[model samples]
Target chain A: MSDVATRLDVLKTYKLYVGGKFPRSESGRVYEVTDAKGEWLANAPLGTRKDTRDAVLAARAAVKGWAGTTAYNRGQVLYRVAEMLQGRREQFAAEVAVSEGIGPKKAAALVDAAIDRWVWYAGWTDKVAQIAGGANPVAGPYFNLSTPEPTGVVGIVAPQAGYGHSLLGLVSVIAPAIATGNTVVVAAAADAPLPALSLGEVLATSDVPGGVVNIISGRTADIAPTLASHQDVNALDLTGAIASDGPGAAPALEAAAADTLKRVVRPELDPFAQDWTNAPGTDRLLSFLETKTVWHPMGI
Target chain B: MSTVAANAPGVAGSGLQDVAASEASLRRFLHGLPGVDQVGLEARAATLGTRSIKTTAKAYAIDLAISMIDLTTLEGADTVGKVRALCAKGRTPDPTDPTTPRVAAICVYPDMVATAKDALRGTDIQVASVATAFPAGRAALPVKLADTADAVAAGADEIDMVIDRGAFLSGRYLDVFNEIVAVKEACKRPDGTSAHLKVIFETGELQTYDNVRRVSWLAMLAGADFIKTSTGKVAVNATPPVTLLMLEAVRDFRAQTGVQVGVKPAGGIKTTKDAMKYLVMVNETLGDDWLTPHWFRFGASSLLNDLLMQRQKLTTGRYSGPDYVTVD
Candidate 1:
């Protein structure tokens, strides 16, 4: 009845991304996400272990087609992601500022860095194979050359700390895994999942195929173990597990990964304290690749 | 229900009573059958597929699934050596583990039946051969019958024949029915012993769930020992919903007539998990009667390796890799 007319803000219901579609967790459970000041942001899907398995299935199904595509086409698809991300820069910066308790200027800078990271990896899609593979000198009369192939589906534990770290860390993990044709099932940052979930939107709008990049927003502990022990997952990144609770956290995941002999990438330093702005090296790009050495007999 | 019995051959002493006296009667009978609610059927299948079979149940299901495989190799490039290797795999899926049960049968093309028969000698494993021009049943009637006769003469225990889908889609139901009866008759050897006749509908070409249901009944009525879902050559092969619908047809057909018909969902079923889902569906839908190898079979080649790997996992108490199992 007051003279002042105030409108209600329409908040988003954050959901998980699987096979290029946004769907609620199959368990139908959600958790409240709050900003730096403990103010209600949104209710994010509390993805269960089953959700992790489903995401892996989708990623595995996508591996053949995504890897079979020409490297030039892959580069074009990745660049499309950067274009989409640039278009949504304002929304991402605002969300990063609220999630990390940072000022607007700092959040904008972080968003710009994350956008530029996608373009950087986009250019590397067609070049990684050439750099990682080459001819080998053999003892016999034969032509031996090693070519890098994708190691199938990869499971990633995205960085789960603050604002800039969440977005930048996600870009760091996903770009390398996919730039070389491997698909990914990522467990997004539990605390600041908004940026990662928004990135799923960008990926879907880009030429990135369905099931190439699946994002699940939930507790890292609840989801990481299933991905670690899954028989079909070819590799796992334990970047977020280093910052997780309990003394046996990272080691237990590594042990589970050993059941499948998955190629495990352990963070070299404390994940939360690392400087994400520094230029990433080829170590991450080489993590999810397998080298196949071809031999041909030298004909007379 | 009584109407199906009146037309079905070898049922109620009808001796191939014509189900479709006229085109109108054929349409009436097909339309009279229950309409399939596609959404509900798919939902039911997906719900059953989510049942988490673990530990003892998973172990048991894996073995049962292995035993039910009609280990198949139907490629144009198949040779005697390939059939021999396939028969060896069927007899002993996992050579390292003697506990592995031999498969139900070894399915091959008609010309390879002699090799499979020779390789499976002195074993209870049956040899199944695809006849009726196999993947495409486009030949003349005489040639199709001769194809079935050759496989049966070569000691095939079962003959899988494809229906002329071109005829079935063009409203010639009677022609389709007569072709199945002809194939069934051709399965008889000179000594009066006959190979079991399995009719393949190739559901992917049938185009609709309602068509699947109609063809299931038609194949059963024409005296099919087993109603198969596909020839494994189409884009959309045996899916869970289609298999579930076929299971319903067999269940209902058996209810009306005293005779029992089997179901085989062939093609695209590769993993142990997928085999388990089909087993779960059979268990819940048709009950325990259809759980045996005689009543249900998976026409697959790669599915056997996955089942063996899972079986090794159960016995070894640890996950087994592909290197541990033989690849034939």
Candidate 2:
């Protein structure tokens, strides 16, 4: 064997995903990521409130076209994400094993389950309106129909810590938000942000439009307040906050979100301990949606 | 016509005098004015826009911006009722609070000039009109001249005239210069008082920053009292860098000729934050001299309500919604 190794692996530089492009945080700050053994993994961009603001701008700009897309077309695009994630299964599995201190078989299973979760939500995209909306029986000579529409931009606090959950939790929160036609600004898990950042790359190559999914990797405490209080953000998901900042953080964020009357989704259990492989309920799908009832006179 | 001689004291021999005399001189004058570094200008404007004006200064800027607005209605569907409503809004922007200072002027189409003047009668608020085949400037010289004459005859305190973009782009510099001079003469009333002439470059069509700077000097040299950025009708109207270039031109013109010309950046400036950024640029670039409504104005329609909402927030310490403000 040679005394000196000739080759070295080129590690990826994780960046914030905004407006469909991967850019370094505007503050030029980064945090160290490590494996379960405490070895240095990579430096992830420490996003700031400005990054959250830029993400909100991008999300708001994307609302009109993304919401106007046919449900069938949205489903096809989401399925395309699954197809791309499946191609990168090995890379994600390896990362998950190292980050979560799991064996290869468990990592593989986790990656498979995450991909299948995407496919499940992909199928739900077309059927959500049918399940959540219906005709409202009203008195008098009128026909009324209640249809669900996107509530504009939604801010997501993805569950951090632990490899399998970090990746799957992000997919769980984000797919439902966007599948229902709302654009999302996701604050990915802080310690285990590599998988989420890599997913941003997958999203870019997939058919998803820019600005539809803006992912920021940073401390949940630092980014969540800005996302919650932002006047333009229409909704928020507090999954990652409950995981990273303890249960007390969610209500503070929820109270701050009340300033703008944001539609908030609070977690029922510890986000880090949830079994992401199980079938997700329809509550996530109904979180970011608003129902609009249309009335028409029979004589018309 | 004699106003050109009166205004051309220090401006002469600086190439502003003989711009229309020869094509070579006009080319030399325009080309001789410093070349614009696009990247540097945009960076400087973006950096200035980051300055945070809070609390007391925010209130001051909001009010200053409100006072500088030229409440305008130039749509094809504008009617006498619309003009009257705009006039009332201009007179008292916030009816609940009489402390709100009235706007500087009310701008409208030339045919509505008389209605605007009648509605704004017995007040210091000026009735400005867009004239000289405004927004396009594609008419014959006689028709353009008559357009200005008609607005002036209808008691328009100010005439906002569009430069012939076709002539300016094709290097007919003298035609553009003389057209401005003719409009300046047409702004003069029979009673020996001339309405202040504002020359609009329609800078969106005049693509290059170099063109914007050159035309600024051209309009000022030809006896224009104010040099406006756009007609508020283009895809890109009144960007910060374009307005910054005009502010620089006015500063330089004042330094050379000892004549101060006002700068108005019209269109796309819709929010209080946007107006505050422009005011910050003006404050830093030209100092407090241009901060007054006499030297700076925003030709906007919807900007008033936003300014009012922000002002209410400043006074009440709570955010106000759109429903509280009246719809024009």
Candidate 3:
């Protein structure tokens, strides 16, 4: 701990999330989870179905304020999260090390990499929409456009147990989704909830208002199907779901999501070393989209 | 009224001095018309021609000397077969060995120039080269002119040189004119079959239609044989609007001075539809004479396929052929 941090009085705050406010879980239960060094960090209150409903409501509330902001301003706000992450980087490194079971140095590097990725997407928030989406030259005088916009609330099954690599996979999905204006409900990586929960703390401090991202840590297979089936959830990012040519694994989720017509990104079949420096687009924005056309009278 | 001068610069010992004088005249002309938008001169800048024809038009004439040198796009055994089929069209039917229309000279890189010179030995077609770090002429002036001279010596019938856009954009217009003149002075033929020179304007990077017009006139006034559009390297090269404006300038220049300078639009041209559009534009705007190869040439690799496809459609009742026409 830094001498200043140790000298200053630190505060602890916890509550169930709803409508940009954190409240007690409606179930009135708490679960004790330990960090990597086996030290009890914070008692994360066990959320119920009612708690899930509240988080969705919170996500719905923040949507107007978030998506309504100018693209440049939104880009600036998202970029600020990168700045905040850099500022408290040591803390994230320590938490990631404990939660992810990696060395602190490696965790610190990953945190930096993840933060840098956010900065890249933040700059792109306004521009990618310009490059990939533009005014389509219609046959008539009617002006038509193809644009990338938020896909509303997303349900994500975060990577499962024993895969710390999947945490980054989860971050990749959430950052690109929300960066383009979608709010998310991420099921924390199973057996690796500490880092995910710590990430939630970072978000609470980072100007990412309540419910922009709601993290639920539990059995992914058990919790995911409910999130996927939720009629209110507009899309599903399934990087966490196991790959399957098999009958049940993806097909079940596929069928469940099909009821609601959720957007799905299958796991990479041949993953290369992540060239995070290469610009990410074409793949990200197309994942969630609704082509809306508006018509209005040109003359009286 | 003569396009070719009896005492052109590179004929004797007045190479550098004549180039400097030519550049001075061009600068004076550009400075004379402050409101002019585009200016270019078309001379066989590489060939030693005596007479310098000056025409003041609204648009610049940038004559580009481009020849297709790279054929690696035709790769693999299948590609080899396509090329051979194209070669089969090399002859016109002759009961007495009637010769076919030879390709407009086979342009190749310097190393392959000798091969082209050998292959096109007795043909009326002239071999051309894109010299001076073409498409982007940011190389040293000496190196660029030397590259032109070497290519010409190695059997290039014409030399196409690109002006440095950085120099042009940096407002060093005089230097660009001088560079073209210097390269033109370098393309001397000992046997007196001097090579032709085409100066490329790379009009796309010039931004404004007004600027394209001004550079067109400048190149033409300074003695451009043909003014061409684009090195085919930039994001915006040879759009219809830009070409339309330049073609108007070419027409006006020819009307004023009685000097017929060719116009070449060199990039992003694919498909017979595109070629026909250019042909239509030339015929409609610049008159029927400009439609011939003397005034027009499509600098493209894929244009042949499209032209062949259109030809087949015209001849055959239905479009019956393989996906790609046998290149011949």
Candidate 4:
């Protein structure tokens, strides 16, 4: 095992992640991750408590730069990811095919849908606030108005098994969250990590900064708790959590995130009745939200 | 806008107009005397195998007198030829049968009346003519009266005139009432016989059930022999709701004045089942008396085949082809 670890270390591209820079794991430990078919793939550094603490610090530090931008500018950046996804879709499909045991054609379709979802949410950023927000007529000497704002750094538990669907689902959640001006820390699809890592590569190449979206791939039980319990996380999207216990995992996630008064998105599964042809509106902007009410005195 | 005084009578006792007023009031009193709404019942014609159905009842009664008009369907024309064939099927009585119902009348347009009159000579069948811009009553009153007179003089047994909805909608109620009474006076039986007047209300143009009920009462009060729905021109001419409202109006009018009124629904009624459903509604709503030809009539272009098809279905266990049924 030590020899194998050594060999894996030789292939490691070690870097520090202080102030949004990737570095070697503080614990100096590496673990071999395999596909569903049990074929050895890349070795990912096993994240430690200190490494998680550093990630939370990076997430907290990067929130203002990510959230302070105007909605239109954010939309333009999100649309840029769509264009990038279009170009790298084949790579995504192949990676997904290996991770989820799906054929190339099906994986390709899923990749296309995921990329389209990015474009869909991209257009929604500037409009959802206007449509869902409106001026109110108050019966007093005050000017009343309401608007939706981002919920800040969101922690997402991406699906474990569906590589392409998980990517689509994660993009669906993340795009809506950040489109309205929120940063995110998503736990990559647990059983399928390569496609997400490839996505990280895309984000690295694209206009998105390092800490805007910080992805970690590890056993969900281990990595998700750090994200759920992290004091700095403003919201947590438990959409991808596997809650076989009884009701759902969202209430528990909500209970945990409540320690910091974080906005919690209860885990949910789509009823799957309507397809894209009938589906209306993007829910991404909904998951990451804060309704801040402001007031000003009117002249008597 | 000048509003007229409510409940005030118009020129009731002016010295110079007293004689004319008395005459008009007397004529109106006599005309308002209620008459039976029955036109003789006409048996619907259907062919069964080598033999034809000559009669299911005695003589078919129609709402329109239709006595003096000519039966012109005998022309070399195609559509007329079809109508002529429909009229002819009524002529072929069985050798052993002598009590077959006579074809009530061949209701035709004014131009075809002379011919229809000629073809139906010496027969009990009366020929009816649809006159006064029949489907749409948008023509001038004088022109309509002239048209009605001409058709009547040309041997039309009945004058089927339509009411002017423009006048009705504008609240010119008296004008519509006076116009129908004047047209009925002009329709004198040509051979000194009193030609019956059947007023066509064109019910589809009136938008509401309240309007239909009011119009039905107004037409009856103004001396109408019948109230028909539509020129068959509009999309909403003959619906069950409209018919139900009209039937109720007719029934109530009869109960009040002992004057049974007739109803004719025209347009878009395509099937025998549809016809039967209408019959069932009328029967249930207006009672067995309304099932007779005097009380009800269907103005349909395609109802015969459906009726025959349904009849065939009842007799035979399985359905047969439509081609086997005789077509007019």
Candidate 5:
């Protein structure tokens, strides 16, 4: 080996992504993040409740601009995210391998699947309106039509215990809510947050507007509850919430979400039994949407 | 008039411009004032800004700051409807809660003074008009005087005039002093009761702490009823140090001349916490005499909403959002 004093590698400092800018936790707190084997990897920002409040603010500010965009343009922007992820597939695969304790080949497969998940959701952006909304049958002589609108800002806790699908599970939850024109503030998997944090870089470089999707990592218990009860947040995604603060966390979050009448996506029946490699559906997209029905006078 | 400015011939009084008998004497008097310790002044302002104001104090400060706000809309695009809406918002900041204190005044361009006054009728909330070639004092003496007269005739309770920074910077202290004297005289209405005169320094253009100090005293000596920091139109509006310095100047001015002047730090002060810092600075520097709405004000539009949001957060258990407040 040629000796040049063994060129040192520059380790990445993981930070919270909010409002399109990377900021360390406002609390200046970091927690020791270990690999699957419990080997030290990095210190992820220990995002606090204030971080949740800030992310919610950013997500709320982005709602009008993101939702007002044409659905076709939104699809293109989401598809561009998939393209950016494709180019960085190897970097994410390496991260996934260490994070999930999997072989490179398996990690690569998961990364590919996550990229495809984005593509799948990207295709649904434009079609959700036609499929989820339609003309309704009524007794009155009126042309009544229904259209789906985003439920404003949605807060997500990515699955932390589902076969350690750290990258896949995180991507699966995030892509759908945003594809439907809803801005999101997501809590990455607490145990394995490197891949999720790196996704923020990809999103920033992609065409996604700042504040549209804020990625915050720490204990889900520290962040999710605030999002649940926040008056500004319109919906909650608890798909990965069971392990956030132990047993009954999801139900507690749902109870808090009810204070503001927020629409909640409850965790799976058995969170540990869930898998992200399964075929995706439009349920995640529809769960965070409100149906806007309009009645027009009809005369021929 | 039962006001401190009555001693200085600013509102409903005779000429007090006699203090500066000549240009040389005015310059000697201004330069004769103590030099500012730039580092010390800034350090003290910074230290005071860091003081933790919490809980009940925060709630009180929020309401006090609300009462001291001159809710302003000085854009050229301002319409009658917009001014009326602003006045209504000023009258009742939070329609959801009737207990919220109304703002001090509704500040608009001179042309919109009539509209704001009309809308704010039946309420004690004064209508303050920005005159004397506001934001930029680049007009002739007659034009500036006529602008002040027009706003005064249209029922403006206070006139916010700007100092000719060009003349002040060129060592023509007498020109700037004379201009302020003329504007103060123009503030008089036919009923012998005159509107209060608040002089704006545009301190960001003044270049140093010493200039801010110099102008603060200059404005006070020129019969200014109030001394303001900026027009909220500059790139650098109000900072803690400049405001602190102005507060100190007004303090010393009252000590010497027995004529107290108000202070308004407009622009860039957006949060309840920032407003509290200014309040704390005032409390420490000027004491209790200058804490009332008649003595201090915040010339801001967005700061009102933030203060309301904080006030609501205090009243309600949960945090508030902009959607819960008015658009302004």
Candidate 6:
């Protein structure tokens, strides 16, 4: 060994990101996170029902400010987020490799795909309105126009099953929601939450304003049910619930969300089916959006 | 002018009346009171705030907090219709739930008192009006007394008057003490009853916990029915330490004179959680005797809505949103 004292590797205390601040769960609970093979990696914050309540509140508060930002500015902000992520690629790849129990090369590839997906959603921000909204033909002296608007605060659950690509799947859900100017309270993949928590750091450093994207990593049952039934949460993406907390989680959450008439993105039919590597279309972006139509009397 | 009625409910009896007989005597008495230890007082308040009150207890606290609110609208732009709406809200609170308790009072400006009084005619809710050229007590003695008289003439049940901070800061203790006495005199009506006088210290401008404690004693000695913290107009209004110091004063004051002066911490208190903290402080400090609407109150407008929302959350398992509440 060398005579020089060895540098102690610094470890990051992963925390839940709410309204742009990294706060440990209010309950001060933490649980051991492990690799796919059950080897302990690190302890992640064990977010509770209160955390979901707080995240939704933060998201709701940001809805007006975030949605009011011009679509062009939102696009620029997402692009900036992607740039921030690109610089942190090596850090995230190492995290994904351990959390997902994958080879380094595969983890690196997934990180690259996640960064590219942000760019893809960045391009969609200004264009989705064009594709989804347009001028309508009306009878007599009136001109009707339609535009797509964000569907307010959306609660998204990242893919949590073992086969799911952690970083790619998380980026796929978050980028689309924020690109449409909808602030999101996301329940990250429980089993492999390190990458997701790291992503919060990336988003915070970028141009994304506070509360635009809140990420929590913990037991899906504890976090997701509250978000589903929260009146402030306008919509919920129940993707992680399909495999997390057993078979009944998704349907139970769907029933709870229906009580508030929330616009829910139901889980995929098969939990172990999709590899999360499929090319993403505008469906994720459009699902969390509402179409607003205006009518103007034609002037002489 | 310094003579106070021994039988007055909140004013410490004739035993303490001789203390304010002159400027020198009042100064000696106020200065004789114990100085506040700021750091310990703030830390104690913070510790009390962390007490987890959940489930049914939270539900009960929410209702109690609602009943303690002096649902207020002191805006210059306040109209009859707005005051009417506030009155309805104060009375019913959550219209969907009949079990929701009505507030302790409806607090408004002097001009809006008659309209509020007319709107809330039969309810037990008192109409408390802020007078004494309120928010700022910069007016002359005649103008301040007239302001108090106007609100009382408009059928106000309680008069919230501001103390002259300039006089208090400049060591003119007797001037401030006598003005509170004059405003107390102005609260009298033709029916031989007087409107409850809530003496506001505007403690944010007072600048020290020691000053807050001093004012609390001075106002109580001057025959104030209630000692209020702030007028809700200044930047740093109604902080926990200041309120705590005032609460300590009232506790000590009541012990010495057998008089229980109410405490109202107004301004900057908006959330149910913050309200709960204040309630916890009160329950722990003064015990159950001061818990009633007769002895304690919150001077707030938005605070009522938050309490209602927390009540709804307890009733319905789902968390509530701002959209579900009234805009006012």
Which candidate number would show the highest lDDT if scored against the true structure? 5
By the lDDT metric, which is better: model 2 or model 6?
6
The digit string of per-residue lDDT tens for model 2 on B88-159 reads 999989998999989999999999999999998988999999998988989998999899999999989999
TM-score of chain B of 6: 0.97
lDDT (tens digit, per residue) of candidate 4 on A1-300: 455654444553423333345666677876666776898866666665456556665666677887787778877888888889888988888877777677989778878888888888888878988876767788888887888887777777775533344466567666777778777777766566666666766666667766787766655666666677665677888766675543235555566677667777765464222133223365657767777766768995
Task: Give the DockQ (C-alpha) for candidate 4.
Answer: 0.01
State the lDDT of candidate 2 residue by residue for A1-300, as single tens digits. Answer: 999988988878889889999999999999998888899989999998778877877887888889999999999999999999999999988887776778989988988888998899989988998988988789978888899999988988887643467677789899999999999999987778888899999999998999999999887887888788766788999877763354238888898888779899986565655777777899999999999999988787
lDDT of 1 by residue, B1-328 (tens): 2344354555655432445555566667776788899999999999999999999999889989998999999998999998998998898889888989999999999999999999999999999999999899999999999999999999999999999999999978878877887888889888887899999999999989999999998888878999999999999899999999999999888877767899999999999999999999999999999999999999998999889877876786444445566676
Isolated chain A: TM-score per model? 0.96, 0.94, 0.79, 0.84, 0.96, 0.96
lDDT of 4 by residue, B98-155 (tens): 3323344566666766766676677766666777876677788888888888888878
For every model in order, the fraction of real contacts preserved is: 0.00, 0.00, 0.00, 0.00, 0.56, 0.83
- Single out the weakest 10-residue window by summed lDDT for candidate 4 chain A: A271-280
Global lDDT scores for all candidate models = 0.88, 0.87, 0.60, 0.62, 0.89, 0.89
Best candidate according to TM-score: 6
TM-score of each: 0.82, 0.83, 0.41, 0.42, 0.89, 0.97
Scored against the true structure, residue B262 in model 2 reaches a CA lDDT of 96
In order, the interface RMSDs are 4.2, 5.4, 24.6, 37.4, 1.1, 0.5
Residue A81 local lDDT, model 2: 97
lDDT of each residue in A1-300, candidate 6, tens digit only:
799999997877899999999999998999898887999888899988898888888898899999999999999999999899999999998998988888999888888888999999999999998988999998878889999999999999888763435889888888899999999999988888899988999999998999999999888877888898788899999877864444239888989899899999988887567677779888998998899999898995
Q: What TM-score number comes out for model 3?
A: 0.41
Worst 10 residues of 2 chain B by lDDT: B1-10
- Which segments of candidate 4 are over 4 A away from where they belong? A1-20, A243-252, A269-280, B1-328
